[model samples]
Each structure stands twice: as C-alpha cells, then as structure tokens.
Target: MKTLSEDLMLLIEREISGQASPEELVTLNNWLSADKKNIKEYQVLQQLYRGHQTLLRNNIVNTDEAWQKVSNKIEILQNSNKKTIIYRWYYVLSAAAAIFIIVFFAWVFRINNQVVTIEAVAGNEQFLLPDSSSVSLKKGSAITYNRSFKKGRSVIVKGIAYFDVKHIVSNSFTVITNNTLIQDIGTSFLVNNTITKDEITVFSGEIKCINLSTKAVINNIIAGKKIINYSKGFVVTDFTDTNILSWKSGVLDFPDVSLTRVLEDISLHYGITVKCLPIDLSNNIYVKLHFENQPIQEVLNEIKLVTKLQLRKGNNEFIFFQSVKNESSQIKKQK
Candidate 1:
C-alpha cells in the first residue's frame, strides 16, 4: 500500500502558509501537470485535510485526541484492509495531520521544549557529533533527540544508527530505541528501525537493555553478542550468525530479508533508484551480498550477474528491474 506521498508534505506548507514562493508554485504546477492523476489525488488529500481543519477550528478536537483518533483509525484500517486502498488513504491523512500538529505545537513549546529534528532519507549519510564521535546512517534510517547529548551519556534514537560513541566516564551511556532502552558501559551498536522496529548486535562493550514503553529488557550483553526482539522481550544473539557493521566493511547484511528492501538499500548506497517490476519474491530471500571497494555501476553489474536482474535507467539512477529470463538463480534460494 502507498502510504502518504512525499510531495504532500511540501504542499501542506504551501497551502497552510499561503506564501508559496514563485518557484514553489511553478514546481507544483509542473508536478501536477506531469501526472494526469495528480490533480485528483491532490483534491482527495485536501478533502482529508478539511476534516482536521474543522476539528481544529471548532476547538472540538484536542490535538492529542485527534492524533489518537487518527492512530486508532489507522490501527483499525491496517487490520481490516492491510493491503487495500483504505490503508493508503488513512496513512496519508494521518501523516499530514501529524505534520500540521507538530508544527503548531512546536511554536507553543518553542521556548520550553527544544525538539531536535532529524531525518534519514533513502540514502546513506555520515554523522560526526560535537564530541568527535561518529555515526554511519543507513538509507531509510534516522534518529532524533529533543536536545543534544551531554557528557557522552544516553541518546535517543528513532531509526538505525551505527554508533562509534565518544568515550565517556565510569558510567555507561544509554541509547533509547522504539521498544527498548539500551544502557551502555562503552560500546558500538546497531539499531534497526521500521514502523514495527527491531535491534541487533552491540559490537563492543556491555549493555543493559530495558523496555522503554513497557517492563521488559535484557539484563546485559557483553561485546560481540547481539540482541533481537522475540516480541515477548529481547534475546542475546551471536555475531557468528551475522556480523554487525558489515556495511562498514562495504557490504549489506541481509538474512532472508525482502527483495524490494534489498533493492531499496542498494539504491540508497548508490544514490540511485531500483525496482523489481510486478515484483513478488519469497520475502524470505536470505542472502549476504558484498559490494566492497567497487564502483556503483560495478555493484549493479554484480547484482545483475547473480540475479539476472535487468537494469533500467532514467526515472532515477540505479533504478532497475529483474530481467525476464530463466536464469539458474533468478532468485537466490535458501539452503
């Protein structure tokens, strides 16, 4: 299901602010013109926004309540029409309202609560913090904090981040993720984020994992071990199963992951777009791919060579589809 379109975010600002720059206006016009369905889609979203506007203007809907209602509506829709049209429109409406509420409350809390805004797009990004610590961000990953970290202590994260945390004092720093909060004596780690979320290996040092939203957490895990959620709670894992920070070694580590997600990661790393046409793969396509020390095109060629996937250019870079050929290994099989 297509959850909200990215273009809607920009349009919300233009419409609400009523000060669209000449350039923005031109861009909007062009985008709407480029797609015959754009106007119809835009109108639908506008109608959705009006629902929120009515609640806001009438002061009948508490901001939080409105969002909660939206979330509740979302949960209901997800269960009933998971892969259907209702799921798509609900998400679009939900996210658009969220943006509006965030900006509105931001003004109200501007003086008291300084929210640190961070976004991770579909591309790999490098981060160097104030204390000389570093983080390598994966595509479609992100982390944000309400304020900056002080004394190399705990930091909150919303998306995947490989931390080369700066050395702190006798106390271990902490990292708060979606379902759990990790307390570290000193360590490097990886956190996988999604709408549902997951976590993995702590490369070095020890960590005390605790549930942030509930009463659950691992007692601790020393260096070279990993932790993954079993839904009930977190469990320890071994690096032998999968090496963490393999990306640092110039490879992506995917064990029975979705093929579309795999293509998405490749696109992010190569700064290109890749797709699988009419794509439906076993979703459990477990494969470890290494693209170390190679040019992006070479990487693409390698993937093509192995999967017999075809490369298509020009809606974006690296955008490719699996070729229609009966290859020996069109899709890698599990052992």
Candidate 2:
C-alpha cells in the first residue's frame, strides 16, 4: 500500500505538539475510543515525548538528545519482537487500519457539530474525518473547511498541509484556497498556501489545478509541474524545482530557471528574503542551475560563485546586485 500521507505525518506532529483542532481533537478521542490498544499506544508515546520535552526544556539535552530519547523508545519497542515476543504484536503487527478509523470518526462528529474555528497550533496537529481523509497543517499554518466538508469535499488552507486522502469512487480530492482549488485524484502533496499566488506541487500522481479568481476559473495546471500564480489567478510558470518531492522524499529540486526566480523560491522554502539590488546589465540571461538536496548557505554560495553576483545585507534580506565589471563589459561591447 502507499505509505501514510504527508497529511497524516502532519496530523501526528500536531497531536504530539498539541496543536490539534477541535475536530482533530475529537478525532484523536474517537481513535482512542475505537481500539483499547490505540489508547495504550498513545499513552506510551505520550509519556515518551514528555521525557523529550522535559530534557529539552531543562537544557539537559540538545536536538540530538531529544530525538535520541524518542529513538531509544522506538528501539526498545521494536527490539521486543512483536511476532515472537508476548508484547510484539502490539508494536510489531501495528494498527494502521485501526488508527485510520480513529481519524474518520473524529472528523465525522466535528463536521456534524458545525465547527467554525478549528485551528491547529504547534504540536501533534492532525485531523481525522469520516471519509478517511486526514490533514496535518504545518506550524503557523491554518486550515478551514466548511463544517459541511464531509458533504462536500473542500478545504481552505493558509499555510501548509499534508493530505492523506482515501480514494473517492469517481471524484477528485480538492483543497480550496483563496483563488484556486487544488484537485488530486487521491495523491499526497504538500501545499504552501502562504505564497502570494498560493501554489501546490504534487509529489505523486496527478493534480488538476484550477483558478477561480475570476467569475469563472480561467486557468489550469497539471501534475509534475508547478503553476505560478499571479494576484488574480494562475499563470503558466516554470517550476524551477520540479523534482522536489516533499512527500515520499524530502528532496527539494530546483531546475533550470532564472536566478532571481530561484532566489524567490529559496526565500519561500526557508522563510527568508534573498533579493537582488541594482539588478541590471544581465537581466534576461537564463542560467541552468541545479540545487539538489543542498543546504541554503551552500546553495547561496554556489549561486554567488557561479554568477559572480554581488550581495549585501539590507533590511534582513540578502540583497543581490550585479558587479560593476559586468556593467563595464556591456559598455565595452556597445562601443
């Protein structure tokens, strides 16, 4: 079977972080209700994470220390050997199906209750619905679907979400934002609605992108490619990082695009500003740059070394500008 959706991962993260929505909270409760073992497992996981919080808070542990504690817990559970060991089946056999039901029930009850403001905060944030579709928002990202979401498969997100959607018989799964609706025929994707244009890149399968900013939708997008959105709607734009699969793989792929554009993408990915100042002389030149799974600093250095661009820090942003030599070269060529 396909692995758990990014939405599920986000849900798990939200729950652990305690950033669950009312619907999500109910979903968690419902899951706890479904199987006695689920509650037990949740309790175990909770206690384990509590140790993580304590150690980190006390400064007795660093990032590695926090993660190692969790890892140790996992290793302890796994080494117990579910099939052969008496307690093995509980952790070894796993309860993926049963856990899924927990998400389903929580969503159902929350929807029926007409929840208006189910916001996710920072930890273990997840929501389960009756349809077996789950959404886990990223930190600081918020999502809102109609309380009638179960009746009509639609959601509005303002940050990022990983969706684990159960297949519908014939309809496509849609995540609605302000200007367009991202439609997937049941695939996993990470959506950053925080973009000025609100973009969605499909990690797997196909997504039908439609812009609804006008009275009627005036644009369309396909999977494996990204649609750059303008203020009012979507315009066909190049996906510099078409190969980046935030799902399945954590790789961020940047393909052949403009340097200026690439900087914008990097800024979005890292939540920082990388802009060029006094950009000129070589405005229209397109470079084939690839930043495959590299650190931002490394990527930045690569860009600087390759393009010989000048950079300065201004207003919390790395301002980019062309060197004076490039301008002189243009002047000499004109003569």
Residue 279, candidate 2: C-alpha displacement in angstroms? 1.9
C-alpha TM-scores of all predictions: 0.47, 0.45
- Candidate 2: 10-residue stretch with minimal lDDT: 326-335
| True lDDT of residue 23, candidate 2 | 46
Against the reference, the lDDT scores of all candidates come to: 0.58, 0.55
Global Cα RMSD, each model: 20.1, 19.1
**Superposition error at 236 for model 2 (Å):** 6.4
